[model samples]
Target: MDGQREREGRAPRRWRHGPPRWNRWGDEEPRPRWPWPSTVLVTAFVLFGSNLAAHAQETERAGLDPFARALLFMTGAALLWRQRYPVPVVFGTALTTLVYLGAGYPYGPVFVAVAVACFSAVVAGHRGAAWAATGTLWAGHALVAHWLYRWLPPPGGPAASWGQELVIATWAVAIVALSELARARRERWARERAERADAARRRADEERLRIARELHDVLAHSVSVINVQAGVGLALLDTDPEQARAALSTIKDQSKEALGEVRQVLDTLRTPGDAPRAPAPGLDRLPELVEQAASAGLTVEVEGKPPHLSPGTGLAAFRIVQEALTNVVRHSGSRHARVRLGRDGDTPRLRVDDDGPATGAEAGGGGNGLAGMRERAAALGGTIEAGPRPDGGFRVLAALPLDAKPATHVKEDDR
Candidate 1:
């Protein structure tokens, strides 16, 4: 169970780490660290098949010379472990080619070994090693062919002719170039994938932070009010039954509203198909919002006629007032507060001010409240101005566009 927990914890951290690293030299880069058994078996089959074909060709061309045939078979068989030790395989095959060329055998097995080494080097992300291996193999073959021609030329003439040398050089360059291209393509694809994954992770983190802040502000303020009202109701249960009943009713209403808000938030957090289909609170609920604040012992006052605002603007206004009132009830040691909502030209404006203590300490707590309110407003392409007022109070002013489209009307409509 402990091991399972460890794995579970690491899974998210690994996901949060973004895509896999593409750095070829890094310890974490993906590579076949060990000699894969399947690769070894496949390489062996290829070697055996190629050697058999070469043997048949050599027999048809010049009859089977026992010594030459045995050397060719052994050289081909040795390539089974080429991927495990590419450099060693290259040297071994080169040596075998020199001996075979001297003994009048074909150079086909050596070319096969060069191809295998190139593939291994590319897959292992060792371009320099592949280049060096190809160069050495070509030089060794040329030198061996020159000597073989001096001793025992081909049926027609010397094997070190310009045509033969050109063919060998071209084949070597092609193999090396192909391997490098494959490696580069793999690296490019890995980089693009990593970038996309990082962007997705960042987006997820930002969304999660937004949800957390909303939950904290909503639950903290709502629950705190319910607790306060419940206490007040209990205290006045016997002496002032009527007021106590009203306090209890307020407690019930606040609790229900808090539950509904939490449920809506949770639904938003749910996976898309599973989320509840509920309409979000908008400016239409502003009156209920005022009543809720009034029940929480705040003197919320409205000043202007409600204006027709865009959905986004309306939601922003509601959240702004919600967060502002929440802060006033929780932090401000004030009994009276004013909330003014109006239209100014093509913009919808909201101003929330509280008659709180004038001390600097009290003023600083409003900073967080103002920030939350500002964020709510700005998310809808709106602007907010919040600070301690000159007249020993706190003020929050937000202006949201009535329409997402550019403003077309400039005439002021004062409330």
Candidate 2:
């Protein structure tokens, strides 16, 4: 039973701890502790106040006796389990109240016990049980007052007035109405809490994806350059010492730049709400990419000036170009690549192409680099087209709009 309860996300009921307790409104909580202070105070009120009522109605109803006192105590004590066992408490209180009235005890704070029980039951989602318990008490009172009064205690007492019954009915309606209002408000609060939790989860997921893309773009480009330079340095070490030294120098510079960018990304994770240490890389840094590619033994030609772009669009454009060059170095035999930048009215157009018979090992376009490029474009309501050109090379074309709005849904390749 304990194992089954654990699997079902519930704690097994333990007899040693008595019955499981709950909040006043019976809302489920992770941990439960008994609520006894309020119950004790209420019981005290019922006991002391009933003696006062008996004194006031001494001539009309029987005085407080052992049996009458026991019945009043029973009604009040039942409320100790009102939150945990609302239905049973409500019915128990009503039954004891009925017995007290039948035995000719004067009306007093004994009714307070029934009211508290009914309120607990109604708010605990047991409306029918609460209503039935209350109705049974009221109906039983009418029977004893009007028809059974002759056989009951304090003989020859007149029947209860219709006005008194009307007042009792109105009080019952008011209790149920107030309980219903409280129940509705609690439900609304629970819904708002759930919505806030869901929104937080979504924001966390988006931030995680953004960080993954940034790390991939940075590491892929820098590592590709370093790998190429390492190979060139090893091959030229004996044939040309100066060329090998230049290759080593390029390796050091690329590695240093890569580490700086990675540390910046880590700093964001450590202090997420703080401003970034440096501005994000954008198209304005295109010359740096050109120089890096040249050092990696790949020639890159810039055809046209990139148009002015928003910070977000510029960053995406720069990454798309960086990832494109990285793929060329890692997957192509082409030594030269061309980049064309233009604007079709309000939309910025970027194209990177390289003459290539793609390396047979990784000719397929199913890598993290391609996926990251597509994700960047889609986030800004843009589109990416990356594939082999008809005549020879591989091509990556992006159309990014100036009025950037994230798409609700973005369609991409299976990759």
Candidate 3:
């Protein structure tokens, strides 16, 4: 978990500030959302051209009113900055439209600018502000239309009434509703992405746990055996020539086998297409393991026939004994230890107890090895109990279910 936090903290510093200047040669910042400045420039030309056409058409009936035409042009130009300050832009455009309407200028281009402002506000995550601005603009439009038509009523001006107000309200609501929908979709995508990342992290943690267990089990058992054989070979070299040669040969053989098994377990990290090495040592190697430990200095007591266990169960049993013996050698300060491997009904039981110095000083306590043992037992749907015995020694007892399915098992069967 600590490693995970460190990785997460470092990931953002690399991404948020963008690539450094040296890496900028081939990389580019994300393009803008609608080429906003270009859009504004093109919109200005179109609106100004339309307003000019309207002014020319009306010259004969009411003469070209340069003042109102100029106001309409300015209002259209003001819309160019709507994205930066949506509410203010909408308000300014609405006021200019009011002035133009009051002065008998055209309405088409003013309506377009008002619509653009409403959409921009909604898109900016300001739903309340958008509604307020839309309401103000709608009121201004109604007031201006009423006043303008009072003097020179259109053919259907009286019928227009408050119905025009309803139309403006509907348009504003549609713009806000569409923007809200888009925002909701974006939020959903973000949540799903977060969930996926969390799941991936959890899977990675589980994998690390599995690897740690494998390393502990393999290294602990093999190293302990090698240590015992090497000690026996050195101790008997001059006193017993025949025994010394046998002990040295045992050391060599054990060392080679340990190296091979360690390499096999490590090869699991390779690509799937790669060939697997030899299988891991399991209960089948228990006698040889007990012999190695016995040679070191411990008196291992054995009883009952070793069961024909599945690969996973065998490895679990082997590791339980290995860790227990390692603890005895390292912390027990005990010259003699006893290992009991047998079956209790359907469960395979492994018990390793040492008649060592049980005082607080000698009982150095189980660290990660203890945690690793518990994890292994729990993963096998079994349980382990380890503590200082009342008689003045440390005892480790693990009972693993032989029938536990291979898929649910933690440690891999491969060596």
Top TM-score model: 2
User: lDDT per prediction?
Assistant: 0.67, 0.86, 0.67
TM-score of 1: 0.73
Enumerate residue pairs that collide in model 1.
none
Q: What lDDT tens digits, residue by residue, belong to model 2 across residues 199-271?
A: 8888888888888889988988898888888889999999999999999999999999999999987788886
Q: What is the model-wide C-alpha lDDT for candidate 1?
A: 0.67
RMSD list, candidates in order: 7.4, 4.5, 8.3
Error in Å for residue 389 of model 1: 1.8
Query: Candidate 3, after superposition: displacement of residue 212 in Å?
Result: 2.6
Which window of ten consecutive residues has the lowest lDDT sum in model 2? 23-32
Q: Which number leads on lDDT?
A: 2
Residues 1-415 of candidate 1 have per-residue lDDT tens digits of 6577787785333443346554643426543344556445544654565467557766422333676656665556556566556666666665665566655554454466557667667665767777776777677667766764555534544555778889989998888788878878877887787788778887687567557656755666576577667777899899999988999898888888888888887786678556456776677887887787787787788787767776667766777778777667766678678888787777888898998763232311333445555565555567777767888677878888765532222222111
Q: What lDDT score goes with residue 315 in model 1?
A: 63
